[model samples]
Each structure stands twice: as structure tokens, then as C-alpha cells.
Target: MWEVRLAKHLKADLGTDTFDLVQVPTPEPAAGEVLVRTDYLGLSVAYLEMLRADSRLPIPPWEVGQRIGGGAVGTVVRSNSAELAVGDLVRTMAGWCEYSTGPADQYPGLDPDLFPSPVHYLSQGPTAYYGMSEVAKAGAGDVVFVSGAAGGVGSLAGQIATCRGAAKVIGSAGSQAKIDYLVDELGFDAAFDYHDGPVLDHLRELAPEGITVFFDNVGGEQFDAAVEAAAPGARFALCGALATQIGDHEDRFPEPDLTAAAAKGIAVLPFSTYHTPEQVAAWTEHFSTWLSEDRFVFPHTIVEGGLSAAPQALVSLLKGSFKGNVSVRVAS
Candidate 1:
């Protein structure tokens, strides 16, 4: 089995060199275990923070030489339990590896026919849906704004806000192409490139009346700007800090302004999606239904070259080289 592992605890820099993809003896399934071959690996910004030497995320940090764990979908090639059968598709936390061995229950069976492609299931949708629908509670009459709206969770968060009936959905991105993608492809009411001018100025112009729901993905300036542009009592569903999550970012963990939000009575709620079974179920149910209803767009990008390409794919993801949900096809 081939797997990528942390070469060392990350310090000031992160790149493809940070990982080592090596071959190991494939593990055999125990009496109650199953052996699965990796097919697709989901990449998210969460992994960037996890790689750092001092990570603030609630999740534990990875140790040197540890297997890089993440979301993955694969086929059960060998099974010793009744929970799953050979050739059945499943979602697992056994990412970055060509093969995995675990209890049958850990790799839950998934119907391959559910999504248009296995790639579709590799998403940050649980977080996106949780923030927009639950935390922000976006709905009709709400003027919703999403920061870093071209990335995985942001892309879906903006669209989820729209589906939940936000009267207007506005998004902020890094470039004109991403702005166009948000508005034209994802159905945002308006989209702006933060690089065009002051983020505050962009927000004030696009959401002049004041935004009632702020689905924030990029923190720092965008959070400050959103606080300034928010209507009284607006809900801020704090999701990601893409601006600082990058390894090379200066002030990679800058504190977002909360005092001003308090003075303005805007609800600043920061939450994390643990991707529990309930969360996965809620998102997949809504996602499938929304796609069937033709009211939602599943924006995604799949990187080829299997497991060996996974490291570079993750590096590119953090550098904003791709859009929407990102995944690596680890196998055919």
C-alpha cells in the first residue's frame, strides 16, 4: 500500500515536499475488519492548519511520520464482516493511502449511484450547510453575504443561503473570474473581487442596504468589513479564515474584530462542523434533493494522477489554484 505521511512537523513553509508518499505492506483485514482501496481523497483548508507546528484548531495535530488522514471514498476490496461486502463503495477517514484496514463499521457503505460521480461526494458540504442553514439561518428577506465565496465551503455556503430563500446573495472572491463564477454559475445576486478595492468599500457598494446574514469564509479584513456592513442584529456564521490559514500568510492567525460587532448587536457565531453522521445525512439529503430539483449547483474540481498527486493537489488548493470542492482521484 502506498500512503503519504508527514515528513516532519511543519514549520514556516508548506509545499509538496512537506509530505512523503511511500509504499508499505498492505494490511490484512481481521475477523471483523474490512480492507478498502482508496479511490478519491477530499482536500480542504482544514488540513493546512493541521499541518502547522502549533495549530489552534480543536482537532488534534498530526505527528511526524503519521499517515495524513482525511475524507475519502473507496471500494471494499476485502471484507471479513457483514457490515460491508466486496466491491461495495464506502466513505472513510482513511485518506492519502492506497489501501486501508479497519473495523467494518468505520468505512460506511455508500451507494455509488447516489452522486453524479464519486467526486461529488468529496465535499466540505457538511460545514457549508451547517453554517448557512443552521448557524446563519438564512431565509427570505435576508440579504446574505459570503466571503471567499469561490472556495469549497464558501461556494456551497452562498448557494445554500440562496436555496434557503435569502432575498439576495452576494459573494466576495479573489479575482474577476471567481466573481463571475459566483454570480453567473452559482446564482449569487452580486459578486465582487476584494482585490479591486477596499473590502469595506466593496461590501458597502454591493450590499448598500446592509447585509442581514454574513456567511464568512475569509476572516481578517472581510470579517471587519462584514461587521461594518452588517445590519443591526445580523447573523455572522463564521466558517473559515482562508486568508490566514495558508502557510505563507503573514499573521496567519490574526484575531478578527469582535468588539465592534458587540457594539452593533450583530451576532458573531463561530462554529465547526465535525462531519458527524447526522451532518453527513442532512447535507447529502438536501444536496441530492436540491440537485434533482435543479435549484442547486455542485461546483467541484477533481485532480487526476491518483495518490501520488494528492500532495500537490492540497498545496494548490491552499494557494487558491482551484475552485469549489477539491478532490484527488486516487484510483480508477
Candidate 2:
């Protein structure tokens, strides 16, 4: 079996040279665990930042050559639990390697039957589900705005808001094509190219009345603009700061213009999807229902190259080269 594991926390760059891809004897499933032959791995911004030397997460020296951690969708080549079968395709927080092993106890909520065969569900599904269902609390007839609207979580956030009955869902993307896709396919009420000009100006024009909710994925300028354009009493869900956390860069959140937010009595709160497995399970059910019912849709940015390409894909995703959830195709 081939595995692409991190050599160490990288500082200069994370392209081909940063990892160690080696052929190793495949390990079998341990008791209460499952061994998956990974087909797709999600490249997340959090992991990208963690790959940096000054990362908030300190890496253990002994584990310096370990596999990069995140989520993957794959087929169960071997399983010890009756809940999972040999061909079951499932999603798990495994790694960027071609195969992964983890305890089944941690992922009790996901349907084991959905694995090995590619279902509509993947990395973006749960994120869209949890962010909107829990943090954003978006509902039908509400007007919503999502920053970084073309990225993985942002794209799904927009769609989930739409599915929940938002009267108008506005999305801000980096490119015109992404904007078009949002409006034409994803059912956004309005879409804007953030590069065009001031985000606040564009948002005000689109949402002249006000916005009921703001699901923000990118921080920095977008956060500032969302604060400025937020409708009175708006629910501001702070999910990520992709724009601000670029390449060894960091920025502080500006002091809330209390006067501005006070005008609307808006609520600005930050949340992480890693709250609890119980929460993930509940949120997954909600989003999965929407997905199973065809009420929501997501776009995946897939780069096929197996595990060796994992490092570059992570860099491209963080640099905004990929338009949606970055996935590494390991097989099929």
C-alpha cells in the first residue's frame, strides 16, 4: 500500500517536496475499528494552516512523519463491526493516505451502508448541514448572505440557506463564473463577484432592505462588509476566515462597531464544526435528509492524483485556485 504522510511541519511551501510517499505493508482492521481503502479525501483550509510551522496546533516530534489528518470518503476493505460491511462506503476523519484505520465508535452517526460506492454525500455535505442548521439557523423566507460563496463550505452554506427557505440568498464569490453558477444553478437569490468593487456597496444594492442572516466563511474584508450591511437583528454566523488566514498571515478581528450592530441588535458568533460527535450526528441527519430529498446541491473541486497529490491540493485550495471543496481522487 502507498501512503503520503507529512515529513514535518512545512514552512516554505507544501507542494510535492513536503511529504513522504512510500509503499508500506497494509494494516488490517483492529478490534472495533475499520480499514478503509480511501477513494476521496477532502482538502480543508484548517489542515492547510496546520501544515505551517507557526500553526496554533503544535505537532509532536515523534509524529513528524505521520499522515495528514482530515476527512475521507472510501470503501470498507475490512471491518470488525456488524454495522459496517466489506463494501460499505463511508466518510471518516481519516487522512490523506490511500488507506486509513479508525475506531467505529467515533463515527456512530454516519450510515455505514453508504460507503465503498460513491454516494452523493462527501466532505461538503456535513459542513453545509451543520453550519446552516446549527449556527446560521437559516429558515425559509429569510434573506441571507454568505461570504466566500464559491469555496467548499461557503458554497454548501449558500445552498443550505436556500433549501431552508431563505426568501433571498446572496453569495459573494471571487470570480464571475462562480457568481453565475450560484445564480443559475444553486438557486441563489443574488450573487456578486467580490473583486468587482466594494462588497458593502454591492450587497446594499442587492439587499437594499436588509439581510436577515449572514453566514460568513471568509473573514477580513468580507467580515467588515457583512457587519456594515447586516440587517437589524441579524444572525451572523462566523464559520471561518479563509481570506484572512492566508500563508503564515494573521489578522485580528476588528472591534465590533457596536453602534452599527446595535442598530440591528445583530448577533455575531463564531462556531467550529468540531463541537461534538453528537452534534455532528444530529446536524448530519438534517443535511442528509435535505441531500437525500434533492433539496440541496454542492459542487466538488476534484483533482485526481492519488495520495501523492494531497500536499499540492491543500496548497491550491488555500490559495483559492480550486473553486469548491477540494477532493483528492484516490480511486474510482
Candidate 3:
């Protein structure tokens, strides 16, 4: 079996060299345990925060010489308990490894036929659903804005807002192609490229009267812009600060302009998706129903190459080289 371990803390610009790949003997499943084979490994720019030396993320940072952690879906190749069958599909947190032996309860079983593919289960549906639908309360008669809207959670956030009946859902991405994909494919009413002009100008033009809901994924300039463009009594769901946490170490945390927000009476709700069973169940219910009704599109990019490719996949994800949800296909 092969596994990837953190070689050192991440620097400003990221690369595959931050991790080391090595071979390890596959451990045999013990009593009440199962041996699982990696099938799909989930990727997210949020992993950048977890790789930092002094990470402020709710979860602990990945330690040097230890296997990295992320989401994954796999199949049981050997089972020693009645909880899971040999071919049962399960979701696990034992990432960056080709195979793992763990207690049957550690890897919860998932319905293989519930989604179009296993990759759909890899999306950040819980975070997106919670932030947009619950925190922001986006619904009809509201103009919604999502920053970094082309990335994993942001992409789903925009679509979830639309699914919840937001009057108009707007997004900001890094490229025109993403903008087109957001509006044309994801059913967003409008989208803009943050690189083209001042985000404030773009937001003001997109939502002339002012945005009523902001699902913030990137915090730097976009956050400031949203504060200025937010209408009175608006709502903001602060999901992440990808832009701030990416570059120079000194700029990892940026403060929001609360003075403006206070004057506008905006409800700024900062939240973390703990991915509790309740959260996962809510997202799966709505996502499954929405997909069956043909009201949603699962925008995703499947990266092929097994376990060794996982590190580079994160690099490409943060560099904006991929669109929507990204996952490494470790096996068929």
C-alpha cells in the first residue's frame, strides 16, 4: 500500500513537494474491523488552512511525517463484522492512503446507487447547504452574492441558493469561463470575474439595488466589497476566507468592515460546517431530491491517478486550475 505524509508545513505558494509518498505494508483487518480500498479521495482548497504550521482552522493542522487527512469514499475488500459487507461502499476520513484497516463503525456505509457517481458524494454539500440555506436564509425576493463562487463549496453554495428560490443569485470567480458556467450551467442569474475590475463595482452593477444575501467563501477584497454593496437588513454567511489564507503569511486573517455592516443592519453570521450527521443528512436529502427533479447540476472535475496524485490535486485546486467540486479517482 502507498500513502502520502506531510513533509513540512505549507509555504505561501504550494506544490507537491510539501508531501512525501511512501510504501507501507497493508495491515490486516482485526476482529470487528474491515479492510477498505481507496476509490475516490476528495479535494478542497480548505485543505490549505489545515496544512499551515500555525493553522487557525477548527481542526488541528496536519503534522509532519504523518498521513494527511481529508474526505474519501471507498469499498470494503475484507470485512470481519456484520456492520459492513465485502463490497459495501463507505465514507472515511483516512485520506492520502491507498488502503486502510479500521473498525467497522469508523467507516459508515453509503448507498452506492444514491448518486450518479461516487464523486457526487465527495462534494461539500453540507457546508454549502448549511451556509446558504440556514445561515443566510436565502430565498425568494433576495439578491445573493457568493465570493470565490467557482470553487468547491462556493459552487455548491450558489446552486443551493438558486435551489432555495433566491430571486437572483450572483457569483464572482477568477475567470470568464467560470462566470459563464455559473450562470449558464448552474442556473445562477449572473456572475462576474473578480479579476476584471473592482469587486465593489462589479457587485454594484450586478445587484443595482444592493445584495440582500452574501455567502462569503473568499474574504479579502470581496468581503469589503460585499459590506459596501449590502442592502440594509442583509444577511451574510461567512463560510471561509480562502483568499486571505492563501498567500503571504502576514495576510492570513483579514478583518471585516463591521462599521459599515452595522450601519446597514446586516446580519453577519460566521459559521463552520462541522459535518455532523444531521448536517450530512439534510444536504443529502435536498441534494438527492433536487437532482432527481432535474433542478440541479453537479459541477465537478474528476482527477485520475490514484493516491500519489492527491497532493498535486490540492495544488491545482488552490491555483484555480479546476472548476466546481474536485476529487481524485483512486480507482474505478
Candidate 4:
């Protein structure tokens, strides 16, 4: 067995402050499994929150020195399943590691034909694909508002909405820089800062007619604002709650004003991208096509180093120190 598995671990306090980087023995994939050489590990605001609040997610305790990050891109070094081949570049849920072993079925949507650049496929492919098809339900004539608009998912979601014929696309971000980029570059009708006073107030001014479709990436106050500003007969897609809960702060999930939604006949549908395998496949198809055409962009923040840097990187991502999808380069 090869040794030296440096991994990031989330400890008892559930804060990045307690994270540890340690070494272990590498293991081989069993039957039906594949061993991969990790290249990049994707981080999410939601995942960082879950790391801070271990009780909030459905995952188990972080083993003494097990990896804590998830969503990675890697090359298959060994494969026991026909679905994957050695040297195949793929994306998987395996976290901050140089190498990992898991069932081939655990990862999906890896293009059988290798891409010109494997890193792009690993970081943005699944996230963009998942958000457009499942989270947004993008279609023509819909008015869509995407929060965290410059993010990996939000950027793709915005483009997908436009392609589907949305009448107007509005987005919210953390900075004026992002706001300008969303409108001038990403085709949003209007973009505003989340901290520019109250979101509801700004949204009301921009969308006097109200939004017909709201794709929520930042929950908490933003979610509340969506509920209040929804047009009659609106379709609300609740994809992520990045703002409300962090670590033990999950109980702070903003109470939605359902009364207003009911009065307007609005429909709220909250879902996770990982809710089903079929959903993942559906997203992958949409993403692959859009990505090939350069219609979607996946904004990312690459935190250098490997597992040793995961804790700080995750903390920075959760604190909004960096914009877009956050990832750590674990190998190569």
C-alpha cells in the first residue's frame, strides 16, 4: 500500500479553526470501483456552512484525518468498471486529496471523449449543468433573478435563463465590480449589491412589475426578499441557502413570508442538485451542450496548495473573501 495521504479534516468545533492536515495510507479501489489521481477539489459556500455545522448535513463525522472538501476533478488511474477507463479525466465528489478510491458509479457525466482542458470540465461542468436544468427550470418569457450571480452556478444559471427566453434577467452579488460584470458582461438586465441597503428595497425599485421566476442562491434575507417581491403566479426555485446558515447558525434560516406568496399564488420549490441521479444526468446533458458552445461561464477562485490549504480556503469562500466557485488544486 502506498502511504502519504494528506487530507483536511473538520474537527469537533465544526469551525475551520479546528481543521487538521495529516497523512495516511492510500488504498486501492475494490471491484466496480476506480482509483483516481485528483487534480482539483471544488468548494462551495453551502459545503463550508455544512462543515461549520456538521449536524446540518446528512454526512457522518469527519474521521480523525479524513478529507473534508468535496467535488473534485481527477484522472482515473485504475478502473474495475467498464464505465470508466484508466487515464480518463473525470469529476467526482471525492474531496481534498491527491488520490481517491470510489465506485465508478459515484461520479457521472464525465465526457467519454477527453476535453482539450480537463480542469474546466472538472470544476464547472457538473455545477453549471445541475443549476440550469434542475435548479432554474429555465424557459422563455420568464423573469429570473439569480443571486450570487457571478458564481459558477449563478453565471451558468443566468445564461441558461437567457437561452430559454427569459424576458428579464436580474442578479445580486457582493460587490459593485460583480454587479457591473453581471449586467455589462453576463447579459443581466439589472444587477445590484446585496449589502446596498435592503435587497427588497432595491429589487422593488428595479422590478416594479415583480419577478416571475426567482432562482435563489443566497438564502436568508435574500430568500425572504424573493418571497416578498414575487409576482403573482411566480415560480420560485430554491437551490441554495448560502447566506442564512453557517456552522451552528442553521436555526437562523429566515422565515419566509408565505402569506405574501399565497396572496400572489406563488409556488416555492426547494431542491438539492444531488437529490437524484436522474436529475444529475439531465443537468449534465444541458451543461455539456452549453459549455461546448461557450454559452456558459464558470467563475472560480483557485486556492493554491493541497489539503493543507483547504481549511483557510473554505473559510475565505464562506466569508465571501473570494468570488465565484472556490476550488483547491490538490494535484498537478
**Where does model 4 exceed 4 Å of error?**
1-16, 28-34, 52-54, 58-65, 78-85, 102-109, 112-116, 123-136, 247-250
lDDT of 3 at 24: 94
Greater-lDDT candidate between 2 and 3: 3
TM-score on alpha carbons, each prediction: 0.97, 0.85, 0.98, 0.83
What C-alpha lDDT values do all the predictions have? Answer: 0.89, 0.73, 0.90, 0.69
TM-score of 1: 0.97
Candidate 4, poorest ten consecutive residues by summed lDDT: 1-10
Query: Candidate 3, residues 79-113: lDDT per residue as tens digits?
Result: 99999999999999998898999999999999999
Worst 10 residues of 1 by lDDT: 242-251
Model 3: ten consecutive residues of lowest lDDT: 246-255
Between candidates 1 and 4, the lDDT winner: 1
**lDDT for each residue of candidate 2 in 1-332, tens digit (9 for 90 to 100):** 88777787666545767677888878787888888888887777767556665664334322467776776778888889877778876776667677777786544334654332243445565666677878778997788999888888888888888777889999998888888988887778899998999999998999987888888888777777887887778888887776655444443234445566667688887776663567656656666677677776657777887777777787788777876677888875
Name the top TM-score candidate.
3
Model 4: per-residue lDDT, tens digit, 65-111? 44564677778989999989888877777676677888887765466
* True-structure RMSD for candidate 3: 1.1
Q: What stretches of model 2 exceed 4 Å from their correct place? A: 12-14, 29-34, 56-63, 79-84, 102-119, 247-259
Q: Which stretches of candidate 1 lie over 4 Å from their true place?
A: 246-250
Sort the candidates on lDDT, descending order. Answer: 3, 1, 2, 4
Which residue pairs does candidate 2 place in steric collision? 88-115, 89-115, 89-116, 90-115, 140-165, 141-165, 232-264, 233-264
Q: Which pairs clash in the backbone of model 3?
A: none
lDDT of 4: 0.69
